[model samples]
Target: MQKKALIAMSGGVDSSVAAYLMAQKGYDCAGATLKLYDNPQCSQPGERACCTPSDTEVARNVAARLGMLYYVFPMQEEFRKNVIDKFASTYLNGGTPNPCIDCNRFLKFDALVKKAQELGIDYVVSGHYARVQKDPDTGRYLLKKGLDSTKDQSYVLYSMTQEQLAHILFPLGEYTKAEIRQIAQEQGFINADKPDSQDICFIPDGDYASFIEEYTGNSSAPGEFLDTDGRVLGKHKGHIHYTIGQRRGLGISAPQSLYVCGKSLQTNQVILGKKEDLMSSSCLVNDINLIPWDHLDGPVQCKVKTRYRQPEQPATIEQIEKDLLKVTFHEPQRAVTPGQAAVFYDGDTVLGGGTIVTEAQLK
Candidate 1:
């Protein structure tokens, strides 16, 4: 019997090419598009929203062209509970959340993997630009950066477990974005030339505060902006409207530029300070997930990426407690925000990552 695979098609050129590659490899393939959200308020007119009707239609068309069975899994409720709710509550609690990580953790890897198992599928495939390989020495799976360095997505995928890595496939790991697009064009995929979705799929306009307010039906109360010394600077619209390291739209005039340094949920204050004040040398990470090893026995020197777009910095990671890691940077890192992931890497291999909880000044 032929091995079976389920392709999680997002109606993009990358995923379409992924499905095509899997099918060409002689795996009995099926396509699935996750219907994650449906509210018109969450999407803008004339904008491409993942899992929308048009996206699903394109995915279905691609599946038909590939002669593969296709299905739409309605995951709106799960997405709301896992991604949207977590995003809103994290902001409400004065933390910056990465919903894409949550989506991959809870939806694609966890939920969809279960769905594939139920259908007797041997593997689940997607279009992520990351690679997985088994280390022959340790017989452990390793997640590494894609061949195209600029398009690597291993940062957001650090949460994948060894089991998931064993069964997941990334067909685009070795292919560049341009190659994927060309393949899609050759295959006549409808979304071959479609621009990649930029903003959060649900919040296309990028008004996070407004969307959270409308979704939760509760507006954030106005708060005071404070300096590092707890001195009042000015009033802010709300704490939710700002993030650490933000400098613009502060609605305040000062002799020097001020950046958001922190937020106090208890006091409902947004803290602003000079750029130098944003630097932190160490941070405590929780909800830790280790990829290359079962446990981090001692301090390990590696590069750490605090945000998706930020460059990796030299850091030493030490396991201080169960489910806790202390990442001390060689130099002060700016805007070490809580609720964002601190993904550790050893060269191109992902060592592991976790949620950043708190930071401390350099000694």
Candidate 2:
């Protein structure tokens, strides 16, 4: 029997090319476009939402040209519950969250994997800039960074389980963004020249605060801004508008520059302080998922990244509880915000990751 792959086409140049490449390899291929948002009712005009009608049409066209079967999976409710609600809840709880990570963990990897199994597809493929390889030494799957550093997306994929890594394919992992576009153009994919989707599909305006407010029907009322010494610095628009390391747009005029350092959902306060106040020596990570092995036996020396696009820093990962980890950076890291993922890396290989819950107990 021929090997099979369900290409997770996002109607973009990268995913389109990914489908073409997998088909060229003689694997039986099908295109699956996940309708992440509700239909015309949720569609916003002229915004870069990923799961709009146009995207699905583009994907269907690509599949037709490839002479492959196509599928449209409506995932509005699942996405809202697993990704969007979690996103809003995290922000309301005074922590920044990466919904893209959650989407991969809950949607593509979890939901789509089940769909692929139901359809008897051997692999679920996408255009993510990451690689999965099996280690010969231990006979386990390993997730590695894509060759293109500028477009490396392994940061958002740390929650991938070994099983998910084994059954998924990322053909674009070996190619840079320029190369992927070139491949798409060569293949005459309709979206070859289409601009990349930049905004979160659910939030067309990129105004997260407004979206959360409207979706949850909750207003982010005005709050007080407090200095490090508990002094009232000024009033803030709301806690949702500010984030760690944010300096601009703050109306307060202080003797020196100040940055947002923390938030208190309980007191409805946003804290401001000097840049030094943003630095964190260590943090506690929960909801752990390790790719290579089951658990960390002892303190493992590795590099860690607290946010996507931030350079990985040297750190030691230690397991404190079954589902908790402690990441201590060699040098204090700035703006290590809770609810953001703490992805650990052993060079290019993903060691595993978890959500930063709080600053580790200061000793």
Q: Write the per-residue lDDT of candidate 1 for residues 1-363, one digit (tens) a residue.
A: 899999998887788999999999999999998989879866453365565677778889999999999989989999999999999998887889999999999999989999999999999999999999999999999999999988999999999999999999998999999999999999888889998866688887789999999999999999999999999999999899999999999999999999999998778999999999999999999899999898998899999999999999999999998988999999999999988999999999999999998642111
The per-model lDDT (C-alpha) reads 0.91, 0.90
* Per-residue lDDT of candidate 2, residues 1-363 (tens digit): 999999998888888999999999999999998888764545774455677788889999999999999999988889989999999998887788899999999999999999999999999998999999999999999999999999999999999998899899999899999998888888888888888877777777788888788788989899899999999998998898888899999999989999999887778989999999999999999999999999989999999999898999999999988989988889999999888999999989999999988642211
Worst 10 residues of 2 by lDDT: 39-48
**What TM-score does each of the candidates earn?**
0.97, 0.96
Per-candidate Cα RMSD to the true structure, in Å, reads 2.2, 2.0
User: Model 1, clash count?
Assistant: 0
Q: Candidate 2: what lDDT?
A: 0.90
Q: Which consecutive 10 residues in model 1 have the weakest lDDT in total?
A: 43-52
Off by over 4 Å in 2: 39-42, 45-48, 359-363
